[model samples]
Target: MTLIVGHRGARGEAPENTLASFAKALAAGVTRVELDLHLSADRQLMVIHDPTLKRTTGVRGKVAQHSAEDLQRIDARLGLPGWPEPCPIPTLEQVFGTFPDIEHYQLEVKSGSTAQSRIVLAAILQLVERFGLQNRVVVTSSSRTLLRTARDTAYPLATGLVEEYGLLDPLKSARRYQCRFLILKWTLCRPTLIQQAQAQGLHVSVWTVNEIEQMQRLIDMGVDSIITDYPHLAMRVLA
Candidate 1:
């Protein structure tokens, strides 16, 4: 069976990455979830998709520039389902606290594999340790070097390689980084590729899948997990 991972916490039902979104996904019966992480100015690890806050938060600054206090006051759900109701951006700590039973959390780090981003990885590792989610989470990133650094940290969490720029053989990067998962874009999730990756002992997780036809196709192809904006629809499709 294909595991349904709520993309940005059932983004179709609620604002992306907000607590309300996560609650809706759980209500939709999704146990696995995919979220993005960016470090804030005050060193708080924030759970949001972009390094910049323009798209989601409607603010005109980078997430790393805002302190936790300032970020808390911003209404992340500007015009979404819970408009004007103050859905402040949540910390990874808050996420773990609210949903103790979330089985698999695929966290994508938004920073590149640069030297300075090591701080970002370190912060994430600390949070994972604090919440005891090291075993239940997969830290995914497009940067192979960053993943290598993460692996060197001796953290037990699974590492995943996110496909970028239409990577021809994402498995190569996964192998290089010793990643257990291949985070494929929906377009790259072909049956042959899925089978090949699985045959080589790699789990394939496709992302941003929302269409019923595509979901059914991926399920038929035997994907290990499907990250989607609509978990309720995914559940029905699987059913």
Candidate 2:
């Protein structure tokens, strides 16, 4: 069966990357979730998609400019109307603690440079190890440097390559990085590519797929998983 991974924790249903969003995904019977990570001013692993706060938090600063404690206090319910409650930005540690039994976690590291990517990946791996989730987590990133760092790390955590534009040679890069998954943008998924990736022992996971027809197409194409904003809808369609 094709697995359904909630994108940024049921983003269409709740505030993206917030604890409430994750809970919503869980309630929708999603066992896998995909979330983004950024390093805070205090160098903590924070669960958020954008490097800036304007879109999600309606604030006028970069995520790295604020400490984790401060970031958590800011409400992240900017885009979604009638949310009815404040949804604080969560830490990677908090997510792991709250959803310990989740079948899989696709932790996408959003970094600007190789140096910062390494720093964030190190912190993420340390937390994964601390929580004994090395086997359950796949550290994914669009940054080649970050993926390279993950490949070189001695930690047993799995790594994945997130290809947004198909600019790079996806297969070659994934093979070079020894990634366990090739997370492609929904627009870039094709049956041949999916077959090739699967043949090479890389699980193909498509991202940001929200439409039912598109979801069915990817599922029929034999993709391992689809990352969607509406897990509830996906669940109903799958059922």
TM-score of each: 0.94, 0.97
Error of 2 at 133 (Å): 0.7
Model 1: runs farther than 4 Å from truth? 79-84
lDDT of 2 by residue, 172-239 (tens): 99999999999999989878899999999998999899999998998899999999999999999889
**Candidate that scores best on lDDT:** 2
Worst 10 residues of 2 by lDDT: 148-157
For residues 17-133, could you state the per-residue lDDT of candidate 1 as single tens digits? 989889989999999999988878888878888788877778999988999778877778853745546688998878989998788799898556557457877787788888888
Candidate 2 to native Cα RMSD, angstroms: 1.1
Collision pairs in model 2:
none
- Whole-model Cα lDDT of every candidate shown, in order: 0.84, 0.89
